[model samples]
Target: MFNDDEKPMAPASNAGRPAVGFSDAGKASVKAEHSKEAPLAASTISVLLDVSSSSSTVGRAPLDLVVVLDVSGSMRGPRLEQLKSAMQFVIKKLSPMDRLSIVTFSNKSDRPCALRAMSEAAKSDLKGIIDGLVARGGTNIEAGLETGLHVLADRQFTESRTANVLVMSDGEQNHGDARQVANPHGVPVYSLAFGADADMKLLSDLATNGGTFNPVPDSGNTGMLAVFSQLMAGLLTVIVQDLHLILSKPTSPDDDLDKIIKVAPGDFNQETDAQSGTVTVKFGDLFSGEVRKVVVDLLLVQATGSDYEADMLEVAVSYPDSKGVRQKFRGQTLHITRSGAATSVRATPNLVAENARRQHAQSIGAARELADGDDLEQARDKLVEAQNALEDVLDQANPLVAILRTELQQLLDRMESPELYKAEGKAYALAAELSHARQRFASRGDVEGVRLFATPRMDAYLKQAKEFAENPDAPVPNADEDAEEEAKANPIALVAGSLAFYIRTAVEALQAIEKIVTATAAAGNA
Candidate 1:
């Protein structure tokens, strides 16, 4: 769950774009783990590949844009200039594949502008229309949105691809209802809200249906054109459709740590419900498998949904499910020692719980291998021995036990029954049962508990795991070695060097040309 107060990594005011899954891989030197795998719907996999890889800008859907502007008596001074400027920016930034229509609303206009399709040839015409716009009437924002939708709905943009609607307003609805306009087109209407008097709540809701709510970071200081350009260019970068992940039962067939995971459809934007000191994300239809590493970037928003606040910083989350309620995931606790302080690292409640269930499923698969063994006595003994050797150790740190305690404490805080005590037991019981199903996987030397719960690519994961397993208290890599690694990884130095060389060559060429021209002129004069 993302918090509004968490400053976005890509600031709204920044004209720069966020490096989507590319530069993060250290200058695209690595092959993708998830980017290559096709999501549930193979059609929307455009984002999986690099944007530069394709000759097209096609996304999961093609959006038809209608910039419904509210121009009335109030938008007379700086507001009018900002509004027109914003439209200009939007026109320049709109991708050629996308269609742009301009509509302005005012009480004085005879008929609202009908949506016009944008093209290279039509670009001049759209500019002409914008220039011709007059501001002599009262505000009628609702009417403008209605008109925009009517024009858009007239041409079902969402038939296959997605439909996008952007509404810019500064005041409340003077006429008509924007929400009541049956969006049969499934068009996601995002809004750029302005003016202190406007209903920001409505604008935010409108954007959530797939649109983005972008308030000008600083009012009066922005050119409408500049802001519009930023929004249009920024919107295209979001390619990942479903972000929430679940690991079902991933395993290593060899001694190699394999990352097996699939993606499914779901919406996970900012999780508001997670603010109660418990971050929980509910899963819907999702692709599941074995997961090795999960990295999530949290932007410290300073304070989103508020104006002019700077009290936020980005933080990485790496903690075990703290509120330990019985969960499906039986996660391994990584004892993390950072800053000379040791703390048991655990997965988030949501991820850990889901993973526990996945591990249980893997364990069950192992039981089947145990049953097929030729030596029954050996199989039973091995299974019993493995089960007993770790039973006490596991029971002490059993995820269920910790969860029950936390859940019971929570219930006590609320003055309610600690049902999770029983519930947690059931969750673990189900996991163990799932593991128990694998009766013979152990006997044939084919099973090693639930595959998902275990480390991936046993060799790779084990190699790394053993280093940590054996020297859990050892100091990290030396500063000198780390400095050398940093020197190799730094790309900025290369960029700077290239720019310096290019300037030097340019200067040398200029001097050479000057000498040659002077010599020719001297010869001519003589």
Candidate 2:
């Protein structure tokens, strides 16, 4: 589905029409829709990155990864074993074109392996190092991070690759300033907190600052493996890095535009220049088959006279491709006509739905935070308000609305049960942890049930690979003739294939929380 030949198109010479760059690739298309109203009416213009199946693989980059593991005393038993298995899986999945490094930390940091290309020999050596690791002493996360950063920096200077860090920790930082150490690293850090005791806030902050996701696994080896597999899949399919969108202000004084806000693919960074009316938004990375949507509210004050063209806005996009090639795209002057006729046009349904989904997710997050603070009444009120708001904008048939309704109902049920509300001990702790993990996953715009849903396909691919290796003369698979077929046959071979693992893990954690809550409620009734 990915079209590597699609390029940004220049707008026509016409003055009053909206123009886009890379329209075929769906890179920077602008849609301006206005409500039918009097002279002083508002409109909304959406900027969409349509990374549909037909055009998802614009830029594929080889990965340069650094895996930072925690070998603290807390991770000594099943946690350490799970971590090792996860690392082994990652090593196996990486192609020879990719490079990897390993760093482990307890009271101090140890570099078990330097940046090495992925070969059979390298993988065997890494596996041996992982197998020999023993958990003891305290956690010094800063040392591990620093070592990983150094390894990545060294590799970056020698070769051009998409460098990243995968930090797996199950404890807090007992030495060194992790924030200070990580701030200067050029590579993104994808953190995975292994247990309930892991510092979620710290891991979240680290990943956010590094422009990546932090996923926490549930309390089990299966959960750990699921989260790690998903994270690795995401890392393997990054298409664009350090993507930035710069928007110049509208030229007409009669036009007013609200600050641009991200509606999908999770929030990143936005900056505005008040004097120049310029806005810069930083999108850390764009994966294959990922569509990013941003929305802005616009008001046009028009005079009742002859139709005239007014400049609306201009957008410029810049990012580095997988090969470390700097690519830039610019949009033509966006213009709108002012007329006396009372004609209105509706916005795109999909864009509207996306904005509504973002609002819904944000509301859920706010309500959960309030509940965590023991403000049950406020949390319920927030959820109700969110539901009402969604109903006003989204149709009942919208699947996202249904999901929001279900989540709200679940929260309501939990709040109504006094015994469940006050439940404590391991079950409560696990539920709370999973709840946070689910919220974080939603914030990242990850689809639910992806990991488990993709497992059978992944297994099938592995089985085929084993068969091919044994025979060495199997007919070439014609999977790529259709994107869906190819993904089902070999999920890791496509850009969207890797996301299945992360989504699956998030769904599993949520399911576990539900089971825990249900068991607690039944026991209380007994």
Cα lDDT listed for each candidate = 0.36, 0.55
Would you estimate the TM-scores of all the predictions? 0.39, 0.68
The global Cα lDDT (0 to 1) of model 2 is 0.55
lDDT score of residue 99 within candidate 2: 70
Cα lDDT of model 2 by residue, 248-302, tens digit: 7654354444434333334556778867767776766554444445565444444
Worst lDDT 10-window in candidate 2: 1-10
lDDT digits (tens) for residues 287-323 of candidate 1: 1111212322122111113122111111111211112
Q: Say which candidate scores most in TM-score.
A: 2
Which ranges of candidate 2 are over 4 A from the true structure?
A: 1-59, 156-160, 210-220, 249-266, 271-276, 306-311, 321-325, 332-339, 343-348, 406-526
